[model samples]
Target: MSMFSGTIQTLEQSLNYASAKNRAISSNLANLDTPNYKAKDVTFKNYLAKELSQPLQAKRTNSKHLSFQGEAQPAGYKTIRQHATSYQHNGNNVDVDKEMANLAKNQIYYQALVDRINGKFGSLQTVLKGGR
Candidate 1:
């Protein structure tokens, strides 16, 4: 496959994940004032791990070659996750501090993912255009 295609595909996946995470964080922030509002988050790592471990091919008879792990394209992301039960005296399950921290972390991760995609494009450009 072309380098551009690969980069585009990866970027699309990252963008999807970041957007979903943003939605989750927004929901948590919005429910801060709501009573017994448990924070919700996707099982990102678990889903990703299972996706990674899945076999790509239908069936391979030979055991000599390296077994394929997963598919070329991602199975996409999911926003469906579990809720965190709140134990606060105020009845508000939303923890502002924790949610804020999570938001910051997600922001950083989103930026990093973007940077990596940018780097991929940059490398392709460098390869295409001879050095000055």
Candidate 2:
């Protein structure tokens, strides 16, 4: 009885991940000249894969219901620092060419997600308008 479907939720999560990744790429590029600055990256875990691997459990509808114990939801995305590699003599790991490529890729991904969300809203609007 959720208002939003799983597809929408997944799309939202993807959009957030893309935004976070963009920020990380921007930070890396901005600190390209700084010494000892480790390059940062955003990583996303596939929720669908996790869901398929886990068993179904009861959902609590009321506050009085017992909550699930010993289980925690995994983060959809996380920012990690790259400390093992360095491309510059100053101990900076950020590579300009690589960061620029990543920025372009992230921009495309963000645009695709925005287009998808707009399409979803358009379909919802059509349904609300009685298919008119």
Candidate 3:
């Protein structure tokens, strides 16, 4: 019944995760000189793995609808601070080189997701135009 396929949803979720990861990387770079500022990172792979491993649950359409018992939805992506290592005397763990690399990697990932979504829409558009 849905117009959009599961691939679109997955791409959207991936885009969201990339955006969150970019934010975390940006924050880490912004506070590179702040005292005791621990580096933050979004665990996308782990989150995705855990999410995929879980069974899908039915949505409750109304307040009177019975909820799935003992099934708690996993929380969205989390930004965790790196406290195990300090790269500076101020106790900041953000390494500029590493953050820069991560930023570049994330940018490429974000772009790829965007391109895939655009392709999906393009295909839909073509279909709507009777494959002309």
Candidate 4:
């Protein structure tokens, strides 16, 4: 059964990206007033572009022939780096409103991706149960 193709892989990657973004936003929000604290975010678009551009090698698990797709994913979130931002008082360039908006949007995207994943699994289950 051919499964987990391009968009599906992209969606899965997006899931992790959004999750990491949520954490980054949370961290910035928590340090709202801390001095010299810079806002941080994962370069999700950049990472996604890189992932999409590369030819996907079949991800493997313990055994060679036992090809479990996406079983061994790359450690991506560790690549997140801080970038320069607009100056502000309290040494914090973390814009709360902007971060909040981004958080909401990322949440919606994450939820949509999760729904799609669930739907795919549900369809698989139905097929396994004799397509009833």
Worst window of 10 by summed lDDT in candidate 4: 66-75
Model 1 per-residue lDDT tens digits across residues 10-109: 7778777887888998998897787666777744677677776766743456777666655643656666634446557756677788879989998998
Model 4 ranges off by over 4 Å: 6-9, 49-83
List pairs with backbone clashes in candidate 1. Answer: none
Q: What is the lDDT of candidate 1?
A: 0.74
Clashes of each: 0, 0, 0, 0
lDDT of each: 0.74, 0.85, 0.86, 0.74
Enumerate residue pairs that collide in model 4. Answer: none
Worst 10 residues of 2 by lDDT: 66-75
Cα lDDT tens digits for candidate 3, 44-76: 667767766766656777999876534434436
TM-score of each candidate? 0.70, 0.77, 0.79, 0.69
The model with the greatest lDDT is: 3
Runs of candidate 3 with Cα error greater than 4 angstroms are: 52-76
lDDT of 4 by residue, 1-132 (tens): 448555567668779888888898899899888888888887755555666665555645457555433333343554353556755766678888988998999899889999998888898899899989
Ranking by TM-score: 3, 2, 1, 4
In terms of TM-score, which candidate is strongest?
3
